[model samples]
Target: MKFRILLLFAVAFLLLTTTRLRVHAQSGKSAARPNIIFIFSDDHAYQAIGAYGNKFAKTPNIDRIAKEGALLNNNLVTNSICGPSRATLLTGKYSHTNGYKRNDRTRFDTNQTLFPETLRQSGYQTAWIGKMHLNSLPKGFDYWNILPGQGNYYNPDFISQPNDTTRYKGYVSDIITKFSTDWLDKRDNSKPFFLIVGHKATHREWLPDLQDLGAYDNVNFPLPSTFYDDYKGREAAKQQDMTIEKTMRLKQDLKVDADYDKDWTYNRFDPEQKKVFKAYYDKISKEPAEKKLTGKALTEWKYQRYLKDYLSTANSLDRNIGKLLDYLDKSGLAKNTVVIYASDQGFYMGEHGWFDKRFIYEESLKTPFVIRYPGVIKPGSKVDDLVLNIDWAPTVLNIAGVKIPSDIQGKSFFPLLNGTKATAKVPWRKEAYYHYYEFPEPHHVFPHFGIRTDRYKLAYFYNGADSWELYDLKTDPTEIANIYGSKGSEAITADLKVKLKQLMNQYQDKEALQILAGAKK
Candidate 1:
């Protein structure tokens, strides 16, 4: 009886070993060529993620990305506008260096040796799945993307490369994820792959999936004390077009059925939405503009609408991210592939009484950066070093063994990932230099330049004139009080001005002279 039992155990052990070998063999994933996937979302703020200290935003999958890898607590961008930010990500250069400082600026020059182009040369099958808000067509990527101008919430159209544009009939978030996962399924397995999965959620006129429309409607969100900012000491912050009270869209724009003139709808009307509105308005009832929405009630209504719509959009995107992660594990690609989740730039969610980005404040200055490289990064490690968006290209290039271009302004942070060094320590930019140039835009944000160190930040807003705003970040994390002209601030401002100029020169910025010349006072 004992011999019989031993025989049974031996057979079972052999079977288990054989099964494991067969599973590994049949998976067909390469151990050497690591797949890199960048999941980039639009205007998705760091503070909204569960891992990033947002007490309320439901982002289980985004939080998982951080759990499985490292979370960058101090990520920043050279220029915070959408187009310029994309350019910086692609080229690893600042907006001025990349020649894409303004939304109105021309397309990125393809003449340079882009990271994807290098990866393509190295035989990686690269594909971009969605939302390249590029004014000029994409280049250098092995798979070119076709997304909506800003992408849409429903019935999104994706134009494929070599002249293949297909309209997918579904929500934008799902469509992008499906296409990306589908691409992953059918990719040339002979070569490793790099895919950029971009989402159109949480952008301007935040819309949600049909399932998420009524979320956060019951719980009344507390009003920001700065919500009713009179703009007393903030000369430039007052001129911004991101105020929740001023620039936020209402009614049809927000997908809310309300008693207001439909003509006043603020969101960019989709061609399909126009048709729906015309048919509804021509046959059905029109909402009159004579609605008496008193002060507090009106503001609360807007806040509810904003949270319900915005969080709903985030829900879809996070759900889709989960789908991709599942694919990695189920397909046995988790061990080799590297996954990165980030936003184009940080966004304002009623922080400092604002919604849109393009400010040097904490909400807009800091973006969410999470990465999962199964072997290299330990689970749930958080790094609080200032990293620029441009650093992304070089970091990927370093991981892939492709050389970084001398002209690129960014250095790779790959070493920091493996717990080798402090990211912002070695080539330690004493302070990060930032510039925003799209003025009178959809958000009339004036052009500005600033410097941020470990504790202090100084900014100059010049809308053809000159105005300076300084903040002691340690005391005033909210930036409600600008101490630029305050007495006893001259010494710190002067020190920050010198560091700013030195950085601008290091970055080859010609505009740094403007700051230095104005600092003579």
Candidate 2:
């Protein structure tokens, strides 16, 4: 009797949905299988979005998506680095499982089930149009035109498959968005489409769009309290390679033709380009290069550089996102299409006196996640349940009615959109597990793993420094205080530590366990 009633309810719901869809369809509105557009940005912090409560950066289009659909406050990356995060998202697996853990790491195995590949198999057109930084060339797609690793902001070279590699002399943001829009503009109308638009903006040693270099020149930005952090509290955090004062490059880091050592590591520049580059920095610096900027002044300099460059890069992407959204509505794909905006990993923006992203800190741990699936999702909704980047593929597949592969580690959060609480609310991993493997290069972030519960977070730094740092998110969200050995929280710490171990084992992260244990000893 119960089964019959449930079946009847399902039939009735489908009938009502079809009726509504038909009404819209006949009135010059098309109701077809939803198109999926994932707009991904690079090294953008979760705190930088205006909708995410960043009073500093302005991201209107991203906010528009949040307002139109839902804002997932608790989205996290499996691995906090760029390539690993992207791999996890693609394979719905952890770094160990996916086997791509860092920038120079191995490629994500193409044999792994990918959402795009699944979509293609299900009769959807799949195209990737922009920066895809996997160690291996992009796989599992019909069309791809991607920039080589850490693509240039100017005169970037793109490797379009069928082996057509070419250089385009323009801003990376403009080119990426243009090509993405072009793909959409030329997609087959017979089948639904899944497009991945990845941007290489807001990455290291910030470079602003030429038009945006002077946007915030006059504004004296405030410095984070930890701006001059001397690696005081946690020994593990202090030894990182991602300091704004240290890792952040000066005029020479960016290609400016001036004096000083003209060598920019990780960036290639012509020998003759030195004079113009140094002169650019000389003009931009508010104070003479030799003069030391101390206290708040130094902090403000970093903030200004960060804001101007990051925002400038973001500006083009935002306008492009607006372009895509406009295309959906105008092309009559809006209501049925699902649009998502996210980042591979979160970056640090003056918080904790850092610039790069790698640590499991809040700024770097959480990435921006926005979704817009018109008919099924409530406009302007928000969810606070913890969501992992790995789960994104599963959710995409679920929405498209594709089978979630057994190999995928993360489960779908589609229930959250169906007006139901996150299935993870109960018996779901009460704590999130994280790991960072890349050592020395880029950001000398120590390899670590830990768990983040709703109210507290405990991380175990392995290798050089073996200890745990616990933070009460409710009482101290800034993470200024580490009460790892504090009294009265031992039981909670112990419990969380056990949960962390269990999660590690469950995720085939026995390696992290061995490291954590060694570090603890």
- TM-score against native, each model: 0.86, 0.88
Which one wins on TM-score? 2
How many clashes does each candidate structure show, in the order listed?
0, 11
lDDT, candidate 1, residue 98? 83
lDDT of 1 by residue, 453-514 (tens): 87899988775537788899899877888888699998998899889888889888887566
lDDT string for model 2 (427-477, tens) is 344678888888767676777788999999998777676777899999988
Report per-prediction Cα RMSD to one decimal: 7.6, 5.4
Name the runs in model 2 displaced over 4 angstroms.
1-31, 253-282, 289-300, 422-428, 517-521
